[model samples]
Target: AELSRLLVLKPEILLLDEPTNHLDLPAIIWLENFLRTTKCTIILVSHDIEFLDKNITRIFDISQNTINDFKGNYSKYIIFREKEIERQIRQKKNQDRYIKQTNMLIDKFRYKKNKASFAQTLIKRLEKMEKIEIDAFDISSINFQFPPPLHCGKIIFQSKMLKKTFGENIVFHDLDLDIYNGDRIAFVGKNGCGKTTLTRIINGELECEGYFKKGEKVIINYFAQNQNELLDPNMTIIEYIESIPTEKSVSQLRGLLGSFLFSGDSIYKNIKVLSGGEKAR
Candidate 1:
């Protein structure tokens, strides 16, 4: 409902600051889908690297009191920045030609007999000129491992001419995409570019015209933005979770709930009647 409200405002540019900070998993993904389908100019500041990479196409970086603009998604920014630093280094290496030429002219003219003070001053000025400054580049980096890929049957799914619109806003047009079992796909672009829209059309519920297809026995399950409702109004916080069948051991579940700020009798409170902070809990 909040997202639908935002969509009604007809903004040409959107600014998001840690927009996912308080969102549950489903809400986070719903935002992801919503942003993916949006075609507005968006500027986002987020600590969520995966979300940033999946959504934003440009990076504006401020470092050491200087600002740098990179015309690519976050992942490409890393690759392009490394290459750019090397290019700048090469250009600066050739700048020695300026100093060497100046020195040569000084050597040739300095010994002229009875040279004036003005000439001496000129030589001194040339010698004192500082080298152009181009600072060395530094890029912070981290490496992590992902879960092993699960194999799916070939011809995973297909969609024909999916469509979406919000009043006058048209999110997609005649879109077609096919997924295969072994494909490891990464959607790259700025936020609100339809990555999430396509996900919705594939799963059904989002409106579409042309036929969509999927290989046999494909399973689809998503925790949409409304997963917060799972907190349950009628049940106590602990009772809400206890009602669900979970594979987690009891100790692990308690630890997880504690992380979300529910512990002891606090979990025993009826969530439907809980305060905002407690529901957030």
Candidate 2:
């Protein structure tokens, strides 16, 4: 809907940041087609490699307080960047060697009256030469791993004759399903196709006429679409996180929060004033 509104204005330039976050596959494909066909220049910030490769002609990479421009897609930009870094490293080594030779010449001839002119000339040359400074390159890797799952029965969830409705509007009827352990399932359909409704019914958030049972030791962790709405507006970020039961010390908790990109005074920020992305974090 927002994309449609933006297109109606027919702007010459478009700026998008993480545009695919909540988009379905079909919607994403449609967006790709629309952007590819438009004459408008687009500047987008996305971590989606496939999307960038398909739509973008150029890349502006920001690193170490500098913007490096590349005349190609994401993959090509990466290759170009690596080669550029190697060239810069070689140039810096050569510059260092020239400066060292100039210093040596100045030091060895400074006292000799005949070579004093040569020493002064070298000093002037050294003073006028521009020194090359290398930017700090960060190659730190993040620690990312999922926790082990708890023990559970063979059957995770079993449902029969599941019927969910909101007043006279039926979401789904006579839905029978048996989800087993280690099973991977995806519910995909157009909007208002009972996906969310079915999940809500399964989670017991909404009442439905059905036979639903969970296996022994079954645990459910439900993440709502509007999860940010559930945050307490009165609580500061740190205070809110600390409310949860944990064995971690205060410093450990802060470290954990920093890993999530919440650091310094931002931890004291009230949940009410945080942006959508921040609150979602």
Clashing pairs in 2: none
How many residue pairs clash per model? 6, 0
Q: Candidate 1: where is the Cα deviation over 4 Å?
A: 1-5, 97-101, 104-108, 113-132, 135-281
Q: Estimate each model's TM-score.
A: 0.40, 0.79
Residues 1-281 of candidate 2: C-alpha lDDT, one tens digit per residue: 99789989999999998898778889899999998999999989887999999999998887667887779999998787778778888999999999998899999999999999999999998899887766544443444355678999999889999888888998888989999999988889876788888787667687788898878988877888889999999999999999989888999888878877788999999999998878977
- Candidate 2 least-lDDT 10 residues: 135-144
In the range 16-125, model 1's lDDT, one tens digit per residue, is 87787656566788888888898888888886889989898889876667778888788888788778777777776776776677667667667876654545766787
Q: List candidate 2 stretches off by more than 4 Å.
A: 93-127, 135-142, 232-236, 261-279
Question: What is the RMSD of candidate 2?
Answer: 3.4
lDDT of candidate 2 at residue 241, scale 0 to 100? 92
What is the Cα-based lDDT of residue 7 in candidate 2? Answer: 84
TM-score of 1: 0.40
